[model samples]
Target: MLQRRRLLLLLSAAGCAQRPREPSEAAAAPLPAGISCVPFARALSGIALAGDAHLWWHAAAPRYRRGTVPVPGAVLVFRRSARLPQGHLAVVVRTVGPREIRVTHANWASGSARGQVAEDQSVVDVSPRNDWSSVRVWHPASGTLGVTVFPAWGFILPPRPADPAELAARVPVAARLAAGTL
Candidate 1:
């Protein structure tokens, strides 16, 4: 009986040792390349406006409805800074929560993943006011929210029949709370 118990323990230990380890984020496959955020966002969201990723905000103003409210299908525009000298752009795939969203974009990751498209990546509003003026994006390579807080110009809505009144009517209650207008 004791011999059988020992054999069972050894078998269990062997099975544990033979278990395959889960791949670390670093060990994950590299993202494919040859695309950047602007064209990807433009094609994905059909916003049409072009330039550096940062310039899309102002360039979109005259042509597209612009606001701080995030909506699915809207393009979030990152402002230019020393870290992101040319800026960045991502299409809102969906809202995850009041202050969290999933975005699809390209060129956000570094190294081999640079210029590659990333889909359904997480982005969280880190602004004190919760107005989405600043954000931290998920880093696929690191498997965590990126440490850098990037400034954002806001969202550019797709061209449609939205007038100011209709746009104003669509502002979520959370946005009104952020604006202190609620």
Candidate 2:
């Protein structure tokens, strides 16, 4: 039965009438304001997705302010670039929210909210209704950390599994809670 359900989910995601579930619909909790992405990444990592040591979040950066009151399960996404404070981007891991997300960015020393055009800490309201998926079945989705960002980055990629079926089993949870289920 479990295998059948997983297979169905995979099919629904990749094919079939069931459209791919949006990333926002998979969250099972409400996000509060001031819930920065850095902390969100730190909190969501390992818990929401699989274990990831690369997604590190720090409070009070040597340059920027860390997550003062971040919630668990938020995604710390940013523009794939070299600078941190300037193009820092991320998503709030909630039970329910928007089908798609838009981001705004600026540099660190000049990233003032004066224009009232907040970038990283903007638009965290409850999501509207949509046909988006309630759960996201991802095995290992890592952020961009290529040479564009890391000057001399070098890390060994994981080996392919001998048993593809078993490897698929190692992926994250399939049945994500409905928005607000958390």
Clashing pairs in 1: none
Local accuracy of candidate 1 as per-residue lDDT tens digits, 1-182: 68645533432221000011112232224333445566556555657665677777888867888988888878888888878777888778678898998776666666654445566678899999998999998876667888989999889987652332332233232122212233
Q: Which stretches of candidate 2 lie over 4 Å from their true place?
A: 1-29, 47-86, 89-182
What TM-score do all the candidates reach, one by one? 0.70, 0.21
Q: Against the true structure, what is every candidate's RMSD?
A: 20.2, 18.7
Q: Best candidate per TM-score, number?
A: 1
What overall lDDT, based on C-alpha atoms, would model 2 receive against the true structure?
0.24
| Cα-based lDDT for every prediction | 0.63, 0.24
Query: What is the TM-score of candidate 1?
Result: 0.70
TM-score of 2: 0.21
